[model samples]
Every structure is written in C-alpha cells, then in structure tokens.
Target: MLKTALGRYINNFKGFTHEVWILALITFINRAGTMVLPFLSKYLKEDLQFTYGEVGWIMVSFGLGSMLGSWLGGKLSDKIGFYKIMIFSLFTSGILFILLQFVTTFWGLCFAMFIIMAISDMFRPAMFVSLSVYAKPENRVRALSLVRLAVNLGFTAGPALGGLIIIGMGYQGLFWVDGITCMIAISIFAFYIKEKKKTSINKDNIVLSDLPKSIYKDKPFWLLLFISFVTFMVFLQIFSTLPLYHNEKFGLSEFQTGMLLSINGLLVFLLEMPIVSTLERKGVNKIKNIAYGCFFIAAGYFILLFDSWVGILVISIVLLTFGEIFSFPFVNAVALSRAPKGQEGQYMGFYTMSFSLAHIVSSKTGLEIIAHYNYQINWLIMGTLGLLALLCCFWLNELVHTKKKS
Candidate 1:
C-alpha cells in the first residue's frame, strides 16, 4: 500500500511539457535565492533600528510596487507576450536588488523597495500566462503545482542559506546573493525558451475556448479576489510579522527561525501535489477547497492564541502549511480558467494584484495593531479575516454555480 501510494504521488508529477519544467526550474532558482523578503521586516526593525511605523510604511511601498507590477505584467503579457516581460522583469529586478543594499535612509529604502518589488513581481503574472501557453489544458493545475513545488523547495533552501549568510556576512550578503540568482535564473530561461511568434493564439489563429472577454463582468472572479485578499492578509504575516514573533516571543536565533519557517515549506513540498491530485480526482469544488483552506489558516492563527507553549508554534505552522497548500495552487488554476482568449495576462495580473493588495494591508495593519494593542489582538484580527475569507468562498461558489445555471 505504501509503495502504491508513493507511485501515485510520483505519477502526479508526470506528463508536463518541457517548457513547464523549465519554468519550474526557473522559479526554484529565483525563489531559492530570494533571501530578502523573509528577512525584510526583521532587517528594518533590528538592523536599521526603524520603528514599527517606519517598517510598515516601507512594506506598504513594497506592496504598492507589487500591485503596479502585477497590473502591468498582466496587461502587457496580453499585448507584448509573456516572453519579453519575463526576461525584462527578472534581469532588471536583479540589478535593483543589488543596488538596494546601499539605500539606508527611511525614505530612500521605501522608494527602493517599491521599485525593486515592482520589477520583481512583474515576473509573476507573466509567468502564469506563460504556463497557460506551455502546459496542456488538462495538465495546467499540475503544472501550477509543479511550479509551486519549486517555490516551496526554494523556500526550504533560501531561509536556511539566508540564515547562514546573515550570520557569516551580515545582511549585505543577502542582497548580492538574491540579485545574482535572479539574473542566473532568468538567463537560463531566456536562453532555453526562444520567443515563439503568434504564440497566444492557437493554430487556427484564434482562441477557441474562454469565458466572457471582459474580466470586470465576472462577479465570481471578484468574489474570489476578495477571498484571496482576505486569505493572504493572514498568510502574508509569515513573511512580515511571524519572524519577529519567533524571535521576540521564543528568543529563537535567525537560524532557528529559518528552520522553523522551512518546516512550512518542507511540508508543502511533501504534501501539496498529492493533496491537489486527490482533490482534483474527487472532483471537489475548487471554491469549497478554498473555503477549507481558509478554515485551516484561521485555525492556525487562533492556535497562536496559546502563547504560553512554544510547541504551539509548530502546531500552528502545520495548519498554516496545509492552508497554503490548499489555497495557492487552486487559486492559480481558477484564475487561469477564468481568462478569456487574449486576456490570460490581464486575468492573472488582477489575481496576483489581490495578493499584492493583501500584502499592503496585512503588513501595515498587523504592525500597527501590534504597536497600538498587542500580538494577541493581532492574532484575533487575523483569525477573523480568515473566517471572513471562508465565508466569501462559499458566496463565490454559489455565484459560479448560479451563473452556470443561468
């Protein structure tokens, strides 16, 4: 039984095209070297000695850049093709990441972070659009899961490597490593994936299957966006606040925190593909699965309410990792499925923008709430947001089914 289960797990990874695998490889390299974001909040607060408010503003700038980038990447992918956008986004953002180490002042750092994130995030929507082109329609979700697996694997490596780099060479080492990896990741992509003309259209020179052309008319999409925003609002805390919480509450070192965060990545890497495969095979509603995801995340946050026990942290992360595994891949698949023939880029852009917006709200609100009240209050608020997302997911499911009936 165990061997059969293992074989099934491995089979889920099969059938992807070469291009999809390359995309996954590129994602792994980039995410593995992405040492900056996980440590950004800690860096601003401790290394720079910035107050919570200042750190919040810098994070706001980061999200604003991500929002703009997400919007532009999608819109342009429709026009210019995802190929050009991916190349330009990665190469330019790499240069910016390296330069960011020099900007120490509060305002300067905010502006720099904004610019860096904007360029870096453009790769997201464009890459999603690329997968639509590269992966077979039936295999798209697995393709997405494949790429996410790369991301999780990278997450596992990045934090551990980042911890070593920080302890050995200081924060400056992170910027250089991140910048170099971005360039390296993209260079392989640019070399291997030559631009194919008239790629977005099929052999018939038109898109055959798609939803309505205008994304704005879709109420279900909008509801999903809101659900995603709420889900990620709680989710983004891991990058921004949770690290601080680990150090402050438990007095863990950077290495310790990295190891702790790595467990979430490790869990996702091990479980997401199999779980997604099982759910897909069962023909469960994506929206319902997302609601389940919302529940898990809310439970994770609420677990944090038991502050007295350090073991609660591990339990909380297990739940949150499950939440991430459930939420993100399906979210990507559903957003891709919604795009009309030429609008893949735009749809993905808006989808990613929701998370960017969430990042803006999550970091700022979380920090401010902690500043004004306490961590307990913040946890309560995040748990509430997760439940709110769960409720919205049900409403979205209804809208989708009703629209189909109509």
Candidate 2:
C-alpha cells in the first residue's frame, strides 16, 4: 500500500512536456543565484551604515524599476517575443550584477540597484508567457507548480549558500557568485529552449489581435490585481522588515537569519507541489483555498504579536509557509486561465506588477513604522491587511463564478 501510494505521488510530477521542464530548470538556476535581494537590507544597514529609512528608499528604487520592467516586459514580449526579452534580460542583468559591486555612495548604489532590478525583472512576464504557451491547459497549474517548486528549492539553496559566502568572502562575493549563476542560466536557456509560436485564435473562437490592447477594461481582473497588490504588501514584509526585526529583536547573526528565511522556502519545497497535486486531484475550490491561505497569513503575523520567542518565530514562519503554498501558485494559475490568447504577457506583467508595487509599499511603510513606532504595530497592520485580502478572495470567487454564469 505504501509503495503504491509513493509511486502514485511520484507519478504526479510526470506528464509535463520537455519545454515545461526546461523552463522549470531555468527558474531554478536563476532563483538559486538570488542572493542579493534577500540580504539587501542587511548589507545596507550593517555594511553601508545606512539608516532604516534610507534602506527603505533604496528598496523603493528597486521596486520602481521592477514595476517598470514588468510593464515593459509584457509589452515587448507581445511585440517581439518571449525568447529575445528573456535572453536580453538574463545577460544584461548578469552584467549589472557585476557592476553593482563598484558602487559605494548612496545615490549611486540606488541607481545601480534600480537598473539591476529593472533588467532582471524583465524575465518574469516572459517566463510566464513561455509557461502558458508550452504547457497543456489541463496541465497548466501543475506546470506552474513545478516551476514554483524549482524556485523554492533554489531559494532554499541561495540564502544558505549566501550565508556561507558572507562569512568566508564577505558581501562582495555574493554579487560575483550571483552574476556567474545568471550567466550560466542564460547559457542553458539560449541553447536548450526554442521560442513558441503564438496562436491567433482562442478556445472561444475569439480572434487574437496584434494591436495594442487594454487590460484595464477587464473589471474582474482589475479586482484580482487590487487584491493581489494588497496581499503582496503584507506578504513582502518578510523580505524587508522581518530580517531587521529578527536581527534587532533577537540579536541573531546573518547565518541565523538566513536559516530562518530559508525555512519558508524549505517548507514550500517539500510540500507545495504535492499539496497542489493532491488538491487538484480532490477537485478543491481554488478561491476557498485562497481564503484559507489568507487567514493563515494573518495568523502568522498575529503570532508575532504575542511573543518574540524563537519557538513562536518558528511557528509564525511555518504558518506563513502554509499560506504561501496554498495561495501563490494557484493565484498564478488563475491569472493564466483568465488571460485571453495573445494577452498572456500583459496579464502576467500586471500580475507581477502587483508584487513590485507591494515591494515599494511594504519596504517604505514598514521600515518607517519600525523607525517611528514599533514592531508590534507593524504586525497588527500586516494582520489587518491579511484579513482584508481574505475578503477580497471571497469577492473574487463570487465575481468569477458570476461571470461564468453570465
């Protein structure tokens, strides 16, 4: 019985095309080298001796660049194609990563960071477009789950490796190592993956147009985008504020913090694909799952309010990981499903833009709250935001169902 179950579980990972696996590999390789963003706050605070507010502004700069990148990436992917945009993004971003090591001044560092993020983030919409193009409709969610698995697995490796590098060669080494990995990913993508041709007709027999389109006209998608933006604002606090909180509140070292952050990725790596597979097999309602996820997210932040104990911190992170596993991949699946043919890049770009906007809001507002008030207040705000997102999830479900009925 056990063997049969295990075999079935393993079988869930199969059936994706060669291109899907290649895309997943590319995501893994790129994410594995993502050392800089995770430790940017620490570097700014400790090495650069920047104030919390300054760190926030620097992050905002990166966020602004990322926002623009997402928009441009979508437009360009529609116009030129995913392959060229992705190739250019990977190669140029790799070069930028290397150049970032030379900047010491505040403004210069911010400018460099902005450009680096803009160039790097252009890969996101293109990658998603590629995923939608390559995988079968029924397999789309699973395909995304596979790519997300690679991302989390790579994330698990990146920060842990970054911790060791920080100890051995210092922060400068992180940039060089990250850049090298980007170049390697570029090589893999360039040699292995071919560009997929766009389909001119969708399933509904709606003719796809090459002319400029307006995504803003889709009311339900706009609502989804709003909900996503809000949820991301709360979710992204982990990247910017949580590290600072752990360092200051618990006096933890870089290695320890990296370990703590890695917990989210590790949990997702272990459970996300299986969970998503199981849920799909069971015919679960995606919106209801998202609502549950939002509640868990709120609970995670709420846990922090009661105590600063390491055990509580562990519990909090575990809860947040649960929320992430339940919600994020499905969210992407929904976005992909809703997109009209020939507009995948636009839809994905806007979806990605939500997170980019959240980076700005979370970093700037969160750091300021910490600088002015307290961590407790920040936690309260995050929890409240999560509740709001939960409500939005319910609303989104109703709207989608109503549209189907109509």
Worst 10 residues of 2 by lDDT: 203-212
Model 2 residue 141 distance off true place after TM-score fit, in angstroms: 0.6
The digit string of per-residue lDDT tens for model 2 on 144-240 reads: 9899989888888888888889999999999998888888898898899877787775445653442225677677778878777887788888888
User: Number of the top candidate by TM-score?
Assistant: 1
Runs of candidate 1 exceeding 4 Å displacement: 197-210
Error of 1 at 299 (Å): 0.4
- How far out, in Å, is residue 226 in model 1? 0.5
| lDDT of model number 1 | 0.90
Cand. 1 TM to true fold: 0.97
lDDT of each: 0.90, 0.86
The residue pairs in collision within model 1 are none
Which candidate achieves the best lDDT against the true structure? 1
For model 1, residues 90-141, the per-residue Cα lDDT tens digits are 9999999999999999999989988888888999999998888888888888
